[model samples]
Target: MSILGSYLRLSAADLARAVEQPGWAEEFRDEQTEREELRAPSERRLHETGPAWDELAVLLGRCDLPADLVHGDRPLPGAEDWGYGPPRLLMPEQVAAVERRLADLPFDVLAAGLDPAELGDDDPHALDHLAAEYAALRTFLARTARYRHGLLVRYA
Candidate 1:
């Protein structure tokens, strides 16, 4: 009944190991649980988009983002469907590309370019969550790109 967007940071070695597991999605779940226990929940790795993932997807689509940056383009081999489908993985190179694209498209420009009504919202702060999430996403990508780390994306 509830859906949320989240991601897991992976090293290339871990990524290679992840693909070998038939239940990598569940494994990632456990990993997130462990991470939460170890560190305070972070907005950097967890998207607060909740059920508005579709809207954010549409808005990013309009912005001409990399097909895999938000929702991911490459499907993980053993990832199982958890409502929105299996988690997708973005390579380190893709992360860098997304970062570059985000740098080119400023948040102000993105907000100015899209209308709230088009995204099916009318609140005065219609883009507030989107802005916050986008900022988090930008920071996340920047960090990953700088470190050349891969990202595993999921919606559940």
Candidate 2:
């Protein structure tokens, strides 16, 4: 859970840094110290701390955690159905709503939560006929067999 929390904050910081200098983001560039010191966001870059906090709330809400405690000060509702993508802008009220939902749930639940569909375990063989070829299916079956064996070894 701590790891997840730290990752969320780090992700927010990375976003802020990317916004400040989209180019220097991938590579270090010096800006100060009479020589371009690797251009990194200053501590002040955390000015968007509120937004960062809000992002966590949105994540918690999306995960279906209770959020009433963290965001009681704000009036937004918990987020729902956020899909796989980069972070999007969120209103402060929305952040508050997410906070409220998170506050009400166990931290582990919030940290581990994600839409179950995102964790699909559907058999690839279910659509084997659509492949128009057996080569792909053969490879899939081979991989699946190996995976199943691995599971058996670990669990049974």
Candidate 3:
């Protein structure tokens, strides 16, 4: 099965409620369903515990960011009811910190050191594909920070 990553943007108040009330996420999901606003932007997909996801997790680990930000293949706390897993909540500050780390990352430098062959594909663009996904993640985190919104991310 393929594991996908996605995020939801939530207001501070809602985020607080989610932290305070374990059941808030269920209610939020239901309300979103009622309002017909449940769609989340598609992020990326990989094997739940596969190399591609592991590689990204390793790189993120090197950056010394919060563990929750790049948690791999695990359901977040309280996300089980959503039928995926628990979602990782990135507060505005956490988003800003992650964005800063992403901005400082030298993609070309990292790419140069990566062996595409080890990525398990002969496709010449495997590194590019990973880079694009990383960029997308950065953009999402940055947007969440800029808007003072919390980010709810999950791998499912």
Candidate 4:
């Protein structure tokens, strides 16, 4: 199964609370579970850990981006639920740092660095689709950062 990821926005107050109480983000996860949905209206399903995510991570890593921020399999400090156990807190500063790094990512460089094999062979336009999705994710990250919101990334 493909591993999907979504980003939820957290208010400043919420961030503060989360810092104080690591389980604070669990409420959002519980709400989502109660609704029988993996994502809520306020959250954005940004990318999956396959071709698009993996290729982007590889290219970004080559650019000297922090491995923790770009690597798809990197363990999230405060992530929880979905069989991983209770939710943990994520600091606002950590999210902000990631947002800043994402903002400076060179899309052109990523595209140039991507290996054709990463896109799969069946779909001739896989690269184009990946690029478009990556652009949308970049925009989403910018918007989230502009609002001073912390991202709660959920993986499943």
Give the candidate number with the greatest TM-score. Answer: 1
lDDT of 2 by residue, 99-136 (tens): 44434544344435443333232444422322222232
lDDT of 3 at 127: 78
lDDT of 3 by residue, 1-156 (tens): 756655666678877787777577656754653554344443221112333554566456555664356652233355554535576666767767777777777667556667877656688887787777667666766666677776666555
* Candidate 1 per-residue lDDT over residues 1-156, each given as its tens digit: 757877777778777877888476466656665666566433234443566776667667767666467688788896778558988889888888878988887677877868778878788687886787777777777877777878878887
Better of 1 and 2 by TM-score: 1
Q: Give all TM-scores, in the order shown.
A: 0.84, 0.23, 0.68, 0.63
Task: Give me the runs in candidate 1 sitting further than 4 Å from their true place.
Answer: 40-48
lDDT, residue 56, candidate 4: 55
What local lDDT does model 3 show for residue 43? Answer: 28
Record all residue pairs in model 4 with backbone atoms less than 3 Å apart, i.e. clashing.
none
Candidate 1 has its poorest 10 consecutive residues by lDDT at 40-49
What are the C-alpha RMSDs, in order, of all predicted structures?
2.5, 19.1, 5.3, 4.7
Cα lDDT, all candidates: 0.73, 0.28, 0.61, 0.54
Among all candidates shown, the one with the greatest lDDT:
1
Which portions of model 2 show Cα errors greater than 4 Å?
1-87, 108-156
Per-prediction count of colliding residue pairs?
0, 12, 3, 0
Model 4, 72-96: lDDT tens digits are 2233345445433333233456556
User: How would you order the candidates by TM-score, starting with the best?
Assistant: 1, 3, 4, 2
